[model samples]
Target chain A: MNLLEWLPFIVLIPLISSGIVACLPGRFWPWAFTLLAALASAVIAALVLPEAMGSELSYPFGNWQPPIGIEYRVDAANAFVALLVAGMAALALPWAKASVDQEIPERQGAFYALFLMALAGLLGITLSGDAFNIFVFLEISSLATYAIIAHGRDRRALLAAFRYLIMGTVGATFLLIGIAFLYMMTGTLNLADMAERLPEVSDTRAVRAGLAFIIVGLGLKLALLPLHLWLPNAYTYAPHFVTVFLAGTATKVALYVMLRFIFTVFSPDYSFVVLPLSSVLMVLAVAGMFAGSWVAMFQDNIKRMLAYSSVAQVGYMVLGVSLVSAIGLTAAFLHLFNHALMKTALFMAVGCLAYRAGSLKIQSLQGCGREMPWTMTAFALAGLSIIGVPTTAGFISKWYLILAAVEAQSWWLVGLIVITSMMAVYYIWRVIEAAWMTERPEGATRLKEAPLSLLIPTWVLVALNFYFGIDTRLTVGASSAAAEALLGVPTGGLP
Target chain B: MTDNGILRIIARFLIPFIMLFGLYIQFHGEYSPGGGFQAGIVVAAGWILFALIYGLKAGLEVIPEKAMYWLAAAGALIYALTGVASVLLGGRYLDFYAFEAFFNTPQAAQQFGIITVEFGVGLTVATVVMLIYTFFVRRKSEWDEVMRGSDAE
Candidate 1:
């Protein structure tokens, strides 16, 4: 069989498995089924990546041709993202079983089902070539995410979920409206076709309105600065595994969508030159970088702190996009990949701590470096990556970002980037200090190391941080190629 | 509600016809505007009316809570499996033309696929509507129980 036929299964495996898992009896079967399905998805995505890197692979639903029927189209850009999301799910599920059993003892079947459905939705958003199709997958993922967040051990989880629901619904609606406007203007739902047709009508007021609506809507989803209110609480209170998965995948996918629209569906000239969006994005990105890191320094809850740090990380990615150059896009995509690695590793280490300490407060982590040496070491390593320390994955992306800023002739932005790295150092150090330096609180129970099931996955991700940092071939090659594809340029070696 | 004999009699007389009309809408949807979603809500409205007239306890006896959850899942599964079936038959996913040999024509196979998936949609939509209704209706007591449990804590 031709390998292209396997494209749909990247989404279908998890979609079908979700139903099967929901129907399955007992706890073990659901978790086992989800893991198998997630692994299968990752393998298929991996197999397809090489082909996708060479050329676009298109799968038309029900044998209908594109520009008519919905299509799953994978190129280097989305294929890389699809792999990141599917790979994260595969790696995190082994850790999930132990955490889920502790926190969500009831309705294990339903939880696993929603998890798979959410996985399917994320993959669908990455692979779909149609604009409307992206919206459908976005809702499918967001609805499942809200429900998953509500299952957290804290009662505040419900409030967080509800707040997310309201914000998410508004975002989705704005996106739909924007798509509607695009549909009205271009008369096509297919993104490529719309791109081809949009130039004729790009001057129209409707098209500009659609672009604005799309930016704001996606801004909310990606938690871009002023629109980022819903992210911290949602990430903080979500079940540990849920936070890990969503943190690594969700906003990154949203950023991917924004990148697709700005670079592919709409020309960069139209977005940046004609529209003045570059400066707007640049200003918001810089502001978010400072505000997010500054607030992160003050949070008592470790999860909340990391959530704010994510806001700052998003600023770095957006900063890359605002540069509107090939190297800058590469930097953005590289960070998108690297940040997923480091952040998920960070959250998983936190999950291990939560498993042992039963709380996420900084005080709860006091002396954890002594009690749970393995888990805390993983945390410190991932923390170094987050701080952009040398020979770690985060450093590679920061180097590219600084290079991109220098190439753009933005000396002040480079200064800002350096300052923010220092800010990251300050916040990540607080946790390391709390975990390693401080004495265990009086009357606190002695903590054992987290079980090997959780520690193994945490270390595997931590290992990847160092591995990818040192090995630039895969991350740099794929990201530069993806950047070239997004810019619609011919092959060029790294700048 | 139980003491309102006239209201109960009217609901009992109207319920079957309401469900029959919903079936008519579902089957006729292939030719007309109404389809599974409208049909599902119509049928659910009948069920809701029955509960209103005869009490929730009696309604639960007719369609238990557990069955609602299973049926909701089963309906969606049926819809997905039909698409899988087309794929297994060596066609693209959800390609109804894969069933052409069995049905003797492409159009008939397409019709068959659409009708089958519509039936699945109808089942799911109907059951989910009832499920949401039950959740809302039961929320007060569930909340009270939660409050009582929290007091003990």
Candidate 2:
């Protein structure tokens, strides 16, 4: 009847349109169709502010309360993710032009159609309340993403997709097993109800087993340390557009689920007792941070370097969660949002270079700042953000994280964070130096700038870095609220 | 290229009902075990049955490769758009409680919303199955043709 009530339809619209479009003529203008659907979906998602900013809405499936019918719950946390995924897809329309034109073929419509479905799945994963619903969307997105990745021009893309499929399937199966274990214990799938029920039998082995399965399974998807093998290649060989979309939304959304389960569903107090979970997570995060950056320094291809860097960045976010402090949670959440912007901007720059030079090799990018000034400048700005330079969005999260680590008396972690960030700075500066200082080959001169379409979205993220840096109100505030919410601290008074 | 095999005829006749049954599973999900994902697989199986009996080429002729891709998007879009429509109707994100237009009662509205999304999932899965089959068959046939020509030479 009203805007707040139609939340499910936002997810449903692109979902159904993806299906209908798939059945339509692929020769038809898929870009137009997919774009319109993404835009419309964004509009609808934007309309649901009351749910996102206000409070949680629980829609009882089949008119039955939880423990009976499936439920789709929306609160401040996931609703923003719903908006981000849809908005990114919408903004991707113009950016998708040059990249897709270069990477995909005349059968681009099919790719676009699949792209939309994957978007729907990602959004559904972010928005849905039912645990099973998450698994469904996860499969939908994974299957579609694999197909999309396989459509890439290189043979490596297919291999990469296959590898991802294997790993992703294993992760999914584990998550399913975890859900099954939980279901067997509680006989309910509603997340809220599970949160309530979990505390009663928090000591049960089934619950512990389920927690382990979920942590490991999600760890794989989140690319947390030991389970991160599938990430770099998938990002590198897949279409450039895909790197942007997945980097911006997919992992962060997965992190959201992890936080949701750990804090809200499983009761963090119980789950952490067995493993000294925070310490374990911290070790992994530290490893990811250092190892990812170290690997990035050795890579010649800028795209692959960014991919490794993403792993490292993910570690920082995970580290934030590991601290078990509200400030650390805020830092992690804020960084997840900020990192997506930084990484997306950085990847777009690489994509633009890939478009013109037919390569994203650091050597080939030598003196590109002189040729495609706009694109490379955006690259440098994003790189600075990634390096956590002051006055950029990236610095805000690192600043808080260092503070959190200090507060936790983990002064060693504070040093680790700073040193790893310096590693990011080193690798990033290597690219910047090559792009700006090294001599451009004779033929490489006279390069045209990326089209306004691509440049605009790239700059939007770049601008966001500066904008959010100066005004940490939204990022910091919401993250604090989210962190407090995760801690079960009742953020009512937290200003 | 066999013409009008008995099995093909039987498959053609039964596939639609199977798909309908898949739709029923999707809608009845709240009260049952199967919902969007399972229903999707089932409906996709119907397309698989059609593709196998009539052959991928024949199935392509009927559904078309490009059309199948769009159908996948349409399916997810249906799911997304339905949620958005609910939002426009004043429901929270994925909240189906206010969808009185589709379901007269609050209980029915919730059921209606979930089913609507389930149907969207079915559409996506069905089309994905169809598209994947088309590609596999095309690739296989192309490989086969190349092999035959090489052998003849």
**Candidate 1 Cα errors over 4 Å, as ranges:** B143-153
Q: Per-residue lDDT for A1-495 in model 2, tens only?
A: 655446665666676666555545444467778878989888887777434564676665444566576666777667666776787777666687778876776777558767877888888888777788889988888888888888877789999999999999999899999999998998788788888787777778888889889888888889989899999999999999988888887788788888888878876776565557888888899999999999999999898999999999999999999988777888888888788879888888888888787888887778888889999999999999998888999999899889889878998998999999889989999988997888987676456788887899888888888898889987777677667666767555432
Q: How many residue-pair clashes does candidate 1 contain?
A: 0
For residue A56, model 2's alpha carbon misses the true position, in angstroms, by 2.0
Tens-place lDDT per residue, model 1, A257-336, is 99899889999999998899999999999999999999999999999999999999999999999998888999999999
Q: After superposition, how far is residue B109 of candidate 1 from its true place, in Å?
A: 1.0
Q: After superposition, how far is residue A89 of candidate 2 from its true place, in Å?
A: 3.0
lDDT per residue as tens, model 1, B34-134: 88888989998999889888877787788998898888898888889999999889988888898887997899999999998899899989989988998
TM-score of model 1 relative to the true fold? 0.98
